[model samples]
Target: MSSFVLVDRPVPEVAVVTLNRPDRMNAMAFDVMVPVRDALVELSNDNSVRAVVLTGAGEGFCSGADQENAGRAPHVEGLGRPGFGLRSLELLEDVVLALRRLHQPVIAAVNGAAIGGGLCLALACDLRIASSTAYFRAAGINNGLTASELGLSFLLPRAVGSTRAADIMLTGRDVGAEEAERIGLVSRVEDPVVDAAVEMGQRIAGFSQPGIELTKRSLHAGMAASSLESYMPSEGLGQLYLRLLTDNFEEATAARKQGRAPQFRDGR
Candidate 1:
């Protein structure tokens, strides 16, 4: 295992990759991201491994891009790809996308305050299992980071409703695990992400690898056909669709008369 991952003893055939920077709240640095990407690729190739549980160490699952290396890409000496300026930081996002291509299921263990890119990290997983202590917030609006740096904007709306994504992104609301569960943002809420991930991974691993991989491919491809678009279309179309949904006069009337929040079923 690379230093970037605090590899736990395999839970039978499952591999748990932990972001090792506990002191920094498991923040991403260039050194870390590079190894993490490699670890993901390396682990995927290991025939002994059947599933992946990705998470971080300490009180934070991930705080987003490392402020120090915010604008840089990760590269080994003498290896650089042209036109891939954002590839270093975006490597993690690519790793997330690659999860669907793997023969095993990828589960996210979101244990703490996951902000900015951290939320995107969780979004990349096929299933997200958050701890009770977990809280989520978007960084693009609150901080100066672009929403697309990770996969936040693209994944958020689908995880929640697009309108809720707008409300969460524009307002930068810190969503706790209970509400996250209610909104279907998290598959389950457990005390620690590792336990949650392992429990789910065991269940998912019971399925045949090829069949599981195919299922993952179909699910992500659907998202790819939609969520992988550039931020402009994603943001604009999301807002437009949301506005159209909210424009239903009868629903609005019912919501007002009921004295409760509007219940828009086809939210995202």
Candidate 2:
């Protein structure tokens, strides 16, 4: 609901959440990000929405925390300096977790620079697609701090592998769109990335709701699963649950025979 975040239903079942502070390159100020977290939570509960696309308003996706003016951290007005810092960080951590916890899939449209916390923000999403001009940086090291804020240390290694993540984070270098795609930091690079992300979201929206949600859950579970033996059964259980609960598989088969797309009405 904050002016800093704008949510629009660009297609039938897809919602686009835009970070609206172009002048500051949509910096991750508390005022901007708190609402972003709230908006994702709102969309998660809205059964009408099946997918989400997150992007920034201008050339830059987000320049990380605003150095000039970060605004006030929510609900920390009366705390000491150390307490305030901890609580402020917890707020940002909540945003990252919210993206992972949302029932609907989220695709980050990285239009331009995604530095420090901004990079972490994009990684938190289920998918990422970058504009041709987009770039990313593990900026904390450049700022004389560790490059580990907002789940960066945890997510980056999983995203691009530990060796590559170490190089990027330690060197504090920018990774452009092409390199990002090659390194698997992003799924693809395209012109007008938001449109591409929305297209991807629309494709996901066409599937059965429970099918998609369970798949997302399985993917996240796989990330933390101790071993293949521990993970496979959970994934199989999800498949069986949907296969038995809905007539989607039969409908898909019928549609295939009729040379038409699956209606996916049972899950809806």
Candidate 3:
């Protein structure tokens, strides 16, 4: 792993991936995000990891693609300008996809400035919690580029509605923590956002592994479902699969009768 990214276990089942470039506001330079993408892939294959929290080390989360010095993107060394641009973007796009495809749910602990690709990074997570001092911006427009990069175009509208997403992206304005929460861009605002995110991760980690994973899948599917009628059956099947293959439901019943929390042992 590069020194640009740090992976730590705040709790046994929760892995926190911190972008460590505090001086650059943890910009999405290739050096920083490549390790970040690799780290998520590593955590995805670790069965013991039930949830992941992504945040930055210092006062900012990520300032988008490094404007001052975007280190060389992997596999772009010999490419022509067009190929180089496409490959570089693909590398960053993979990082966003990695977050969504991870087996465990991901939470963005937005501790400070989440701008441009940074905002997209937060939106890619399954959930987001921000520090009171944190803020967000659609920085691409400000830089004379399209405001859509790294799935921000699709995810932002789904997150805060098309009208609001349009307004924010077109204007390239800063959204404070309170506004972020109010607009549904973040789940809540906390003083120490990373700790709050870890606590949420711990709570989620207590559930049946397959249950949580399936729920995460279903939630994402629900977002893209063409129709409720077609989506209902797949969702129902997931519930039945867990119920029949695991003793989680029975464990819950028994634990309820015993006046204690359920101890789910579904290894899957």
TM-score of candidate 3 to 2 decimals: 0.98
Tens digits of per-residue lDDT for model 2, 11-87 = 97999999999999999999999999999999999999999999999889999989999999978878999999999
Clash pairs for candidate 1: 74-88, 162-268
Determine the backbone clash count of candidate 1. Answer: 2
Descending-lDDT candidate ranking: 3, 2, 1
- Compared with the true structure, the alpha-carbon lDDT of candidate 2 equals 0.93
Where's the lowest-lDDT run of ten residues in candidate 1? Answer: 226-235
TM-score: model 1 vs. ground truth: 0.75
- Please identify model 2 stretches exceeding 4 Å from their true place: none
TM-scores for candidates 1 onward, in order: 0.75, 0.98, 0.98
lDDT, model 3, position 125: 98
Q: Please write out the lDDT profile of model 3 over residues 9-114, one tens digit for every residue.
A: 9899999999999999999999998999999999999999999999998999998989899988887777899999999989999999999999999999999999
- Which residue pairs come into collision in candidate 2? none
Sort order, TM-score high to low: 3, 2, 1
Deviation of model 3 at 128, angstroms: 0.3
